[model samples]
Target: MRSLARCCARNERRRHDCKEYRRAVVTYYLGIDAGGSHCRCRLVDSDRQVIGQGESGPANARIGVEALKATLMFACNQAIAQAGLSEGDVARIDAGFGIAGIGRPGIKEQLAQLDFPFRSVRYETDAFIANLGAHQGADGAILVIGTGSIAHVRVDGRSFSIGGYGFPISDEGSGAALGLSAMRHALRALDGRTKPTPLSAAVTGRFDHDTTLAVAWMDQATPRDYASFAPLVMDYADAGDSIARSIVEDAALHVERFIEAVFERGAPRCALAGGLSHRMRPWLRQKTVERLVEPLGDPLDGALLLAGSP
Candidate 1:
């Protein structure tokens, strides 16, 4: 019987096919969000199940290429082990990364040329991915106020950046911005140019009251140092200090202006994010409220979603 013989041949072929014979061939995609502070890596299956996860510290390229590579390897190896597979086990893989301090021109090219194991890889600024994560891939804007501040938005398949120009002269409406403002007030009071306030007392203690301290402090103050002073401004504001209230108010206005710029690009909604966003929301009055969008998930979780995308 030709039909019976053909069926037997088909069965034999299937039996001999390693791929077909394998009962469990798992597939996964990996997503990484790396920053100067920490890096998170996640692996997810088609179902969006978090099959694996890993974490490392300071994987930023600014820290050095060796540090970044080691961090990536450490995280990926942990994820691979958690998924019960080696890098070679996955049938198909895609990767997406959101990296901080990577907006420099040559960085993307460097990352593109990087040799890594994956089926496909896409790398973008953390701000872009944060924009995607906040809005669930919808076209909109995000206001990030943390140790630094930045406005990133996407519309018409293009990205625009506002603020986040580092600290002092730029980072308007950020913690650092407010801190610098506070320091200015303190210095004016110390120099007898303005009435002494609680801020003056606070600043003297912080700067150790060294002569010519303002000059040296300005030169040496990191973004985090300025951000650290943000709480002082908030405290004074709550205590009904006019100057502190105005400082925070100024921060709010700066953020609002940042959002307005993004909205001008045809973005229908804006999402407020970052450490300061939580407190900053209440500071936004009627206008910014109407334009803002609710976040879909946190950044690390967002990476997982991308990992599972078809």
Candidate 2:
């Protein structure tokens, strides 16, 4: 009986030690979805269960490396704290970041070499991960229409992009573009060069209906600032304002062209993403509608998958 009792005690001790060892080897992951408007962080434990989430201000690459770093850290630390972990634990995590403007000249190289707190970090374009999440790692395409716009197609391990050149020159169907068009019409109305509609009056009124004042505002405005006026455009369009209708129709046509380009590239299906995706759906072409598929996940989910990559 004494020998049997001794064996039972020894087995219990071994089981406890084994559990401790397993715990010691467990890993954690962090996923960051950093866009022009905001930076978001999601933390998960070894089992892939979510621990916490946090958000902060914009982290666009154009904001430069130092500002981006500070916002990213702020968001990550918020998530870590919510997960009941100290900042020191950041060193033990693996991370993945999906950032806007990641494909611009030298942007990827700079981000890849950052002194991140994580043990390992991977980086991808926001559009790429949105494609990954939309199709759940399958062959598909995504049109991201936000403050800016871009389309990405993934097929058989190959990927391609369309539009998304940037503000003013590209991103034709994006919010910034729509807002810019609205402001232009408003300026023309103020100069008595165009028929002033309710939409133009309302838009110009924001700048006290003065051309000089509007120009002053534009001189310092960012993409997000322009995008802020998009909702007003949408509202005016919904109310059947002709000028607003024209701007929206033009944007819709651009979106149609983008989708047509995606299908032409051999994507099996496509999903629309970003702040304006759902709102723009009613304006999409029938052929584009036929090829649309519901996303299995979102960019954040794709980012998390990258975080756990071997």
Candidate 3:
């Protein structure tokens, strides 16, 4: 009886060892969706099963290579730790990144020059990954309205984009643009050029209603700083603030135009994506709203797909 029990115990031990060996041999993939507002990291095994996820602050390429690298590493490390792995495992993991501002001149080259700790790495624009994830790499269009906004389409094996040229000059209908408009309205109210509403008053109140202080803040403000006011504008608009409503309406008009252009370019379906997509939807035209479809997946899924791509 004792001999039979020992044989059964040894068989169970072998099975456990085999299971651990199989797990150890499985390849890991890491996907990163780094955007203007935040960076997300996802770790998956060869079977595409998610093991861990991590998030960090903005990782826009415009922030510079070193800073972007640091942000990516922090998120990756967090994901690794969550998966019961260590930093050394990064070298064995394949990585894919969809990063904002990657289309700017020299940015891609700059990123390639960095010594990333991955078995291999693939890079694409954040919009690209979002579109890819939305349609599962099928032909479709996506308009991402986060801190910045851009429209991307994939049709007939060709890809194109509209807007997303960065803040101040481009990125129409973006959070930064909305905030900038709000700030301008607030300043105009202070100058008596426009009537004060709750929205403008709220904006000016942030600076104590002092024009000098507001100017100081603008002089040093980045796109993220301006974008911070977008939620406030949306809130006030929802509460029946006319000026805020106008601002959002105008922004939504631009978004609608982008969607129309995407369809005109031959995209069969479009997905509204990003942080502000929901807020902007109610303000868009019924025609535009009718054309929208739910995305099949998120940017992180696209990033993982890229990680396994040739």
Q: Best candidate per TM-score, number?
A: 3
Whole-model lDDT values for every prediction: 0.74, 0.87, 0.92
Ranking the candidates on lDDT from highest down gives: 3, 2, 1
Mind giving the per-residue lDDT tens digits that candidate 1 earns over 1-310? Answer: 9999999999889887865435245456788877544677888876667889999875656655556767876887788789887546654667778776677657777777777777777777666777878877777888777666777887878887777655566777877787788888878777788776786668766767654876788787666677778888888877877778878898888888888888887777888777778877778888668768788866655554555465
Compute the lDDT of residue 257 as modeled in candidate 1.
86
TM-score of 3: 0.96
lDDT for each residue of candidate 3 in 1-310, tens digit (9 for 90 to 100): 9999999999999999998787667678999999998999999977787888999999999889999999998999888889987555666789989999999899999999999878899999999999999999899999999999999999999998888999999988999999999999989988999999999999999999999999999999988899999999999999999899999989988999999999999999999999999999999888779899999999998898888832
Q: So what's the TM-score on candidate 1?
A: 0.77
User: Considering every candidate listed, which one attains the maximal lDDT?
Assistant: 3
**lDDT at 264, model 2:** 90
Q: After superposition, how far is residue 29 of candidate 3 from its true place, in Å?
A: 1.6
TM-scores, all models, native as reference: 0.77, 0.92, 0.96
Clashing pairs in 2: none
- Model 1: CA > 4 A from native: 1-24, 36-38, 52-93, 117-119, 211-220, 301-310
lDDT of 1 at 2: 100
